[model samples]
Target: MNQINNLVRHTRLLEIVGDLIRVRALGVAFGDLAMIENIDGDQSLAKVVNLDRDIVSLQVFAGGKGLSTDAKVIFLGRALDVVYSDNILGRIFRGSGEAIDGGPELPTDPRIPVGGPTVNPVMRVMPSRMIETKVPMIDLFNCLVESQKIPIFSVAGEPFNQLLARIGFQANADVVVFGGMGLIFDDYHFFRTAFENHGVFHRTVMFVNQASDPLVERMLVPDMALAVAEKMAVEGKKRVLVLLTDMTAYADAMKELGVAQELIPAVRGYMGDLYTQLASRYEKACDFKGAGSVTILSVTTMPGDDVTHPVPDNTGYITEGQFYLHNGFIDPFGSLSRLKQHVVGKATREDHSQIMNAMIRFYSGAVEAQKKQAMAFELSPFDEKLLKFGRLFKERFMDIDVSLPVIEALDLCWLTLSECFDPKELLMKQNLIDKYFPKSAHSEAEEGETVAQVA
Candidate 1:
């Protein structure tokens, strides 16, 4: 180890394999960022991935291509840090915190370190508030509670990214931090354009690692997004929503690096610490004691639509719940929000809990009715009603394009139920039915009139 401006520098490389390098250097800490300058004057960045006594192993950000054995490596004695300020909002940055939006260069003041520990348990408050996303299925059924960490589990070819962008713009929060890993140019452009066109770009910050970028940057996107979100929630007293797309990519990046470092592979070639790495990011969602909150809603694409896949399997144990996305709709039966109990009837309308339950119960019955009809069983009059209700349910509430506030969604739930079943058939509390059930205007005469009008 040689000292240049009090920073540790090593001028020899013992090994260079697939973007990984080993050097005999002292005083190097894990996760420390170092500058790797080759003799050709081309410089790149690397991070200390492993440290064993006097030997340090780093993963070069720009890859170890055409590199000599004696490149100068300078350890910065600090972990990866991202620039943070009010100007960071509404800006687009790469996973490495570099501005790629052709905007003016931002000052490097108040750079905050990424990949920090989770918030203290004592400093976290119980999540009791709701994040209204104006999506009927999410807002009315699976309420997105503040400070809740959840994922939208889906597979490829689904509109999960579009759904994510909708929530990013429509969600009720003081700020939105979006982290996109392994996105193509089209998907990246879609998110930016969606936020801009929907008038949320002013308060949205995006950290993107495109498919063509270095694999190491994919793992940095979440850490950068979460770090900025935590800073805003704790220090700026702003409610922040962090949206990460395709956590599978992040996990795959870890597996690739693990293989490069010759570490023992866990299940499916992933590193053994996949769960810990995921929990560290998801746990960033917390409501500060006296400050604002950080709520995380990420997308985890299951390979081959297998929930048993290690990424989603581990995530299921770590997150509060998941919104299962399939066939371009948020599957009501497959989706859940475990933290919704804290806010269902408390922060929302009194009829929320009742409406949610009755709708789902009836929908389940409707599905069974369809199955019975398909198998050539005799259909009862009630089964006919269920069939009608099922169609209206999918058309009105389940569609991803349908956007309604929580209150309006609750009212619509009542209308949809009334169109098919009598108030007594709802099986809800009598008092709730008395207060919210449709009156004579939605009764037989009006129902006949509605049919006539449609006819």
Candidate 2:
């Protein structure tokens, strides 16, 4: 408030609207943290979300069920802040930044406000570097470049969480900030256990809002996680990989809160500002011109697998690209990384782009051959080869369980290609083939000689 503390306390008139409290306090700034003291001497967290002429609308993090008009509202004179430090790694936090892992509080750690400004574009470098997750679906097909904002689009019954956990352990980034919104306790445990077993938790900070947590907290989970990530990337100069799962839940929380606030519904009953709200978070992905970067990989589940649903639809507009996870695999036909060109060939091995394109192309052909076979048509020799290659390709690389370095994955591509057809039939660059083709795909005489030498 602009006035002295006594004047601020004198005008403490307010009214509660569900979870939102309108306090008629003058000169109150947005994002100012506050507390509502109830008659029972219990205080709950609140933050300034809207500022009218002189009335400030505050969203209570803990619902306002027990609050009253006469409750003493105390403004903390600052934005919502989260405790930050290297000590935060391997820790679990609630949406309000309180520890929930039976561990001691981290109040002594340095504090950083949530939802800070993103890195200036002029100060940001082009995301030319890649972060290898060792998952062919990502590393080979849609390379995860530094600071790229992307989402995994999937339907229910898909293994997006498993895929995310795999990436968390496999990515070579210096730090991992995992924000799990509306996750079941089991999923939360799975992420924690996966990171622990893989030895990545020591470099990870997890902020979770379980399905049972307050709806308001669920909305803040992403901001809190990104806040910590920004700290590590800017001050610590670390490559931070932020993994947010099931952002559909995040949007749903917003819808529920908007309904609570009596806001008009827009497209498909979602709040009208859905796109802007999402971009504010996704836009936080940044690659500092000289410092480290923050790359975002999130999951947004589609109801009934409908791409046109409000959440994923708006996300498509904000993020750089998306990984469409469906039918237990990352869909090569649907998945794309717009920034892959900056790294696939330039940063990876010279054959990375060629192998990626070739593999997906063959996979498409294999699908056609399968359709023809299903029609009871006699398969040609080429069709038969396609059938054989398709099975091996899926088994060796496409399956989510199949994890390998970019080099090994590329080598496997050549093996599957050779097993399907002669080198001339591949239609890849002649120079690339001659330079990078595997010896296993060589002539029969050369292969036998190699086998004999091995024997």
Candidate 3:
């Protein structure tokens, strides 16, 4: 043991202590740098087990690949402090918030603590305003309300990243905070270029932890993102939207750390407190009683497309509703936003609620009709009409490329309905049809004649 100025550094050989390999006499300072050193070989890493009064525990980043009994341990004097400020916008940082884009170092401002206390419940306001993404399915159908906590439930190989990028570019939010966990380098570059190309980088802040980064660092992303979002929202910036991709990676990091700490596994080798951990991040989305709000949209990928996967299963309980991403598009039948009703008719046009419901009901009939046709059943006249309606509905509304405001999209719905069957077959209220339906019945008649000519 050597004492210099009041700090001591003691080196001890590695030994097993209570299911953990202990490197005795490691120098420790109060919540300072918590890092591990390799012992025998230069390439191996060790895992930190615990930290006490003057002792620091470290877990190796490389899985003890080249470590042996004799190694060196060094402790820096401080806990991890993620740098944040307005300067962070347009800058790309690693999962640990270190600038990685070959840019200048971030100027620190009072070093805000990551994963700080939640916003007070009494300070929260009920969410009301709509957050339009300009995606027809999200905007015209399931409207995303401000301060809502929603997740996109998908599987691997799906285009969730693309969907997220589109929303980041198109959302009407004042600012976007994006956190990506365990992303591949290609996907990382995809988001970077997507934001830059769309010219939204000025208002976007990204925290990325690549698959090659330290798994321990993956745990820091959500906190980093939420901390920045809270700061922006508190400053009266309305509509701060946070997008987190691959929350499943974040959970896996937790499980790995739990296993390293020798904690007994709960479900599927994950910690029993998994739900609490996720809830803490999700609950950060709230409308301040007087200030702006943070709305959260995260992607939770299920393994083998299993909805019962612990990550998605727990997420479903915590979030308000979910958007199911399937086949490179948002599935109309599977995707839903529970708060849509709050804005569908009230915040949107008078005809929105009726047209939305009627269109979906007709679309469902069309799906059933298609199945009957596949079975070679005799087609009823209504069935044929439903099939035609379904085709038009998908082309006009279900396609992701369709972009329109809520009222315009609703009017288009009425036009599509009129193009199909008569107004009475729609079963919509007569007053709505009289007010919003197309005035020229002859238009549909002309379209029928045109189709007849082609047939």
Candidate 4:
């Protein structure tokens, strides 16, 4: 309340629908924060969401409740910014960047502008470093590369939020920044407790928007999360991994606004510019050339688990790749990380590619064998072998609960393969088979161990 309204204040309301307010104003820029003062001297915050000649439309962050047409509106003269500091780590903030955990305000002036321009391509370095999450489905199969933008595609009942929490603790990054939109109190508490119990809260910052918050603020969570991450990577010189959950909710927020504006619907009732709106946030993923990097891992839940849903469909176009979560596991055949080859063989072991291919091939074979059995066909010796390999693969590697370093998992992979078939049955190089086939090896642990050790 002590903050000064150091600019001209307008007392007019062109329209008031939902949380949006349109007023007569001049020289108001997009994304600028505005203060709406009620007749009772109570103030609420809003952000300039649109502008047309002399009329500026603002999204009231605190919702458009108890305001009159005569309420005073003051523009803050600058784009929306979230306070930046190392002190934000381990703290929980609301969608508007206010600390919601009863913590003291993070001190001022270096505010990071939300939804800033994407880092220039000329300044970006090729994303080559692998970001290991100690999850076999990720580090071992489709490796997550530093500065990569990827999403977890899952249905509503799937445990995607749990997977995000696992990555928060297991990902090899200097800091973790989480943005949760439209989450219920239980989901919010789950993330907090998981991070705290895992002892990674000290290096994480959470920006959350609960389901009961106004839809407009839900739209700001990604921007706030990314802005804070940009500050941390560029200024603090840290490798930052940003995790956003349920981007489908964010898209729904935009769709609500579009409906309120009486705009024609595009794909599945989403805005026609949905792709552009999503790309603006996802393209923010950057390697930052020489300073540091900002990597993104987000969840995009599909309606009815349909990949054709507009949100996940558009997301696939902007992100590098996606992880498909199904049946309590990241489906190995469905998930992909496009940048994995940049480091899988170069940064990882020489046999990394061979081992990866062989396991999937064997798993695919196992699936076929199970199908044959379903049809009541007589099983052959080779079919039985594949059936056994398939079962072990899911148990040892595909389960989300299975957490092991890349090398440790690889060693176990060889153990799994060896237990299933003869050396020639693997169809691997005889030289590699001779050198690394567990029995002739000095120690299987030492072989797979050094490949991804530095990741």
Q: How many residue pairs clash in each candidate?
A: 0, 0, 15, 0
Candidate order by TM-score, decreasing, is: 1, 4, 2, 3
lDDT of 1 at 214: 81
lDDT for model 2, on a 0 to 1 scale? Answer: 0.87
Query: Candidate 3, 183: how far from true, in Å?
Result: 0.8
Can you give the lDDT of residue 287 in candidate 2? 95
Assess candidate 4 and give its lDDT.
Answer: 0.89
Encode model 3's per-residue lDDT on 269-326: one tens digit a residue. Answer: 9999999999999999999877899999999999999999899999999999999988
Candidate 1 structure quality by residue, lDDT tens digits, 364-405: 999999999999999999999999999999999999989899
Off by over 4 Å in 2: 1-15, 445-455
Q: Which candidate number would show the highest lDDT if scored against the true structure?
A: 1
Error of 4 at 281 (Å): 1.0
lDDT of 2 by residue, 103-174 (tens): 877767789889966677898888899999999888889999999999999997899999999999999999
Measured with C-alpha atoms, the lDDT of residue 343 in candidate 4 is 91
| Candidate 3: residue 208 lDDT (0-100) | 92
Ranking by lDDT: 1, 4, 2, 3
Runs of candidate 4 with Cα error greater than 4 angstroms are 1-3, 440-455
